[model samples]
Target: MTETLDTTVAFRATMGRLASGVSVITTRTGSTPIGMTASAVSALSLDPLQLIVCVGNHLFTRTAIAEHGRFAVNILGEDGEDLARTFAAPVPDRFAGVAVDDSHGVPVLQDAIATVVCQVSQALPGGDHTIFVGDARHFTHKSASRPLVYFAGEFGVMS
Candidate 1:
């Protein structure tokens, strides 16, 4: 037990040093939208245009993505720290007062630096998280924006 706890703590500390862009993964169940802040998102393939996002097992957004079969990754800019914290919090109705575009059937943040709509292609087990592999379907980006980054448990912009 001690070894497991030590490893977990060490793992988190080591991973924290590696900066990552922040994003909001969104999906819908009926007309209600669900979303969560995420940093464990990455491109998995280019040939098939795939992306991978790890969702915690305890999050309801994980189940929503599984059932909905689609999701949008809203890449946050430096101006999006508040949006990140809002979705990360336990607040009910994270979308309240937030502008969104649901044209692709998945809620996309209008203020995001970039947005990628994807169709879920595979779901794999990843320790305490579910690894969702998605096929890119639609995408939009703003070239001039700076990405919101997360490192050492704090949010910032790239130097």
Candidate 2:
């Protein structure tokens, strides 16, 4: 038999053990743009070019992404901590003064280490979070900058 976890406590402990790359998930809502700092993103496959992102059900960006049907994942560079926090907060104008442009109807941050515009291929309920599977249509990368990393609830820079 499989051992069941205490859930809440076990979840924090288990997640704390996993180190994740930091990303800024962006979706446009009407004329406004919304985004959030996320670490729970992973590549799913290369055949169809897919990736998975886990978003909390209550986040506004989650709803925006669903309605918009697409999103851009901006993989931040080492100097992007402030930009990440700006988008992650519950502010009215998250994209104000930020240099971003539309990429196939998705918002892509400028100077990101990498960016991927994806169409929502599937969405499913995953306990406290929703699992979003996306099919990447366009992608770009820069070899110059090091990526900003998130691990154990903190932001880190690769040296």
Candidate 3:
């Protein structure tokens, strides 16, 4: 038998027990670029090389992703708090002067531990967000740095 429950308490308690890697989601439209710090990225497959990103339904970045049909996940390392803060804010033209480009023409931040470029395969409605499934087309990695992590509502450095 299934029981109904409120998400307010359940979500917080459940999230409290989970630790996630931090990433900066970046996208571009022509020359305009936007970025956001998120910890909602996850791997979905290996054979077909798939990844998933949960974007808030109401965020401008989500609209950008839908319109552009592509995005880059910049896996941040332990020293990425500054990058995280800048992206998480409503700052104007956050990618200005920063070493980045459309690796797949999708605005990937430089110096990230890894960059994954993908084409959105599906977008399904999921509570307060939309789950975007991406087919990984290209990827790059730098194995020299420890990853940045997020847990219990705070940022952490991987040890």
Best by lDDT: 1
Q: Give the alpha carbon lDDT tens digit for every residue of 94-157 in model 3.
A: 7766788665878888868999999999999988898989999999998678998888878889
Q: Count the backbone clashes (under 3 Å) in each candidate.
A: 0, 0, 1
Q: Please, what are the lDDT tens digits per residue for candidate 1 over residues 94-159? A: 999999998999999999999999999999999889999999999999989999999999999975
**Stretches of model 1 off by over 4 angstroms after superposition:** 1-3
Q: What TM-score does structure 2 among the candidates reach?
A: 0.91
Candidate 2 structure lDDT: 0.88
Q: Model 2, 1-159: lDDT tens per residue?
A: 344667766878788777777899998889787899999899999998999999999898899999999999999999999988887788888888888888579779996899999999999998779899999999999978898987777888888
TM-score of each: 0.96, 0.91, 0.89
Q: Please report, in order, the local distance difference test score of every candidate based on alpha carbons.
A: 0.96, 0.88, 0.86
In TM-score terms, which candidate is top?
1
